[model samples]
Target: MQIINARLRHQAALHSLTMVDGRFTAIQAQSGPLAPQSGQYDAQGLLACAPFIEPHIHLDAALTAGEPNWNQSGTLFEGIERWAERKPLLSEADIRRRVHETLELLIGQGVQHVRTHADISDPSLVGLKTLCALRDELKEKIHLQVVAFPQEGLLSYEGGLALMEEAIEVGADVIGGIPHFEYTRELGVASMQQVIALAVKHDKLVDVHCDETDDGQSRFLEVLAYETLKAGLGPRVTASHTTAMHSYDNAYCSKLFRLLKRADLNFIACPTESIHLQGRFDSYPKRRGVTRVKELDKAGLNVCLGQDSIFDPWYSLGNGKLLRTLDFGLHICQMMGHQDFSRALDFITDHSARTLQIADYGIAVGNPGNLILLDGEDDYSVLRRQGDVRLSVRQGQIIAQRPAAPLLTPPWLSA
Candidate 1:
């Protein structure tokens, strides 16, 4: 396969790309003659870049808004309560339908890779079982990683640990825990320990929903970091939605920051959901409820952004576009400077790939032929307007394409 008239991120001019046996075999300047191939495409000089990565999402509970009832309070706890009310109603067909729709939306938005959490707190493990089947079904078009997430708690829920272990045995790729949601502080710490131990036992990755509350006293993040460091699974560990870090005192957070850096843990911030769910308790001088994105970047830590919910109990709006997530991230983080804007682009693309620990996941030779062509000239333009992806190609095949809009001219200026 040959793709002509392409603009790579580091190139000065449009170029051509060649794929052979699902790997990017060659990339040359457009000035060179085209090579013979089975197929060809002219991008019309559009920019081509690596596909976006969604590091944190809940596929099992997605697209479930207004199922039984609406969330009147619009708080995180209310969403959890509503989900608890709605969980028992989930069937295999119901889960498969929503998961397929969500994955299609993600693929249309240039997200070829995703890591979704499946609730395993239930003894039946229905959500995890459904997602594992969907993962196998969508393997050719989309890459999925399912986490055995204990949305309730490892010890608080009845038979939670046993069910989580069963999920891993079935085919879960990661182990997850909601430590801050445990009954007590001791239980929270114990939950973290259990999550790490289970990951080690199953040889799976660790991604924990740590300290997602606005309380300054919620310090499970420290426990998570300490366990990751002690277990020697730092790179494979991820801490999602540490919103409590924003409420902690400067001195304590400063100390914790040092330990987190030492752990080399990955951080994922849901700017869209966090901004909406947080600051509800404050009458004035409200907080952002998001983690220290700029601070973490400055400290050389890997920080990524996630559109945590889409038309679900937690959030009421989303279209699976990662660029929209980047737009919100820049505003909430106050990262509008030139350098910061460039880095914000990485928040959804490169930084997220790092969080997912994807191997050979870039636009380079000998890598899988997965890339997206944006309707913008450069990164600045892409983020400035939240540009659209005109084309999405996976494994040398064009899976999705957006038609180019027709050019319009004013009637008053007609020749």
Candidate 2:
């Protein structure tokens, strides 16, 4: 199949792409007759980018807003309590229904790769079992990665460590823990060590919910960095929601950055949830509750953005759109400069693929022909307007395409 009049990111001229047998065969600036074969597409000068990747999300609690009750205080702990009250009621049937719906929604939004944290602390393990089945069911449309996350606490929750081990054996792709939720700081650090050891023993990946509070004293990220260095597990480990770093003083953060770089750890920030769940304690000049995205990117570290919640107990908003997620991140993180727009978009696309360790991503020849066509002229326009993904192709097959909504130019407004 030949696709014509497509704009490759970072390149000015319109180009044509050729796909053969589920792989990109040719990519060059359109300079020839630009002939089309029997099954061809004309992008109409729209921006063409690699398929989007979601580095972190919680599939278990998705679309469960107000299940038992709403989060009145809009606090992180309240949300956790709500989820705890609701976990026992969870069944494979409900999880299957909601998860499948959510996956379809994401696929339509051009997300072809996703890493979702499914809570493994459930005594019944129904959520874990449901997600594993969904992962296999959605294998062709989207790549689903599951993390056996102990949301309650690794040490505080009864038999948490054992359940996590069983989850990994039962086909969870990653090992995850919520160390900050433990009973003590010592327990938190110890839990991270256990999480890393489990990852190494099972030969899986590690992504911990580390230091998600606004307390500057929260220094578990340093502990995770140390563990990463000691275990020689560099980029395989990710620290999600290090919101506490926003409050860390320059001296301490500088030292932390040095260690994080040496350890080569990845970071994922959920900007929407960070701002909503954090900063509740401050009276004035409250913090933004996000991580050091700019500093991390400048240091050549792999940083990505995630839609941490979606109509769930924690957050009551989000529509499975990566463009909006990136925009929210750029706004709160104050990364709106012209030079930062392209880089911010990469937080969900190229940068996220790196964090998810997707080896076969990108638009280069010989790579799988998975890409999206947007209603955008170029990268800047796409980022500025939060352009919609009009067409999504996976493995050289067109999977989703939505026509542009009608322009509602009312007479009064236009006049």
Stretches of model 2 off by over 4 angstroms after superposition: 32-37, 413-415
lDDT of 1 by residue, 130-244 (tens): 8888889889999999999989898898888888878988999989999888898999999999998987877889889988989999999899999999999987999999998
lDDT of 2 by residue, 306-376 (tens): 99888999999989999988888989988879899755568889888888889989999999989999778
**True-vs-predicted CA distance for residue 233, candidate 1, Å:** 0.7
Q: Superposing all C-alpha atoms, what RMSD in Å does each candidate have to the true structure?
A: 2.0, 1.4
- Give the least accurate 10-residue stretch of model 1, judged by summed lDDT: 30-39
- Model 1, TM vs. native: 0.96
- Global lDDT of model 2: 0.89
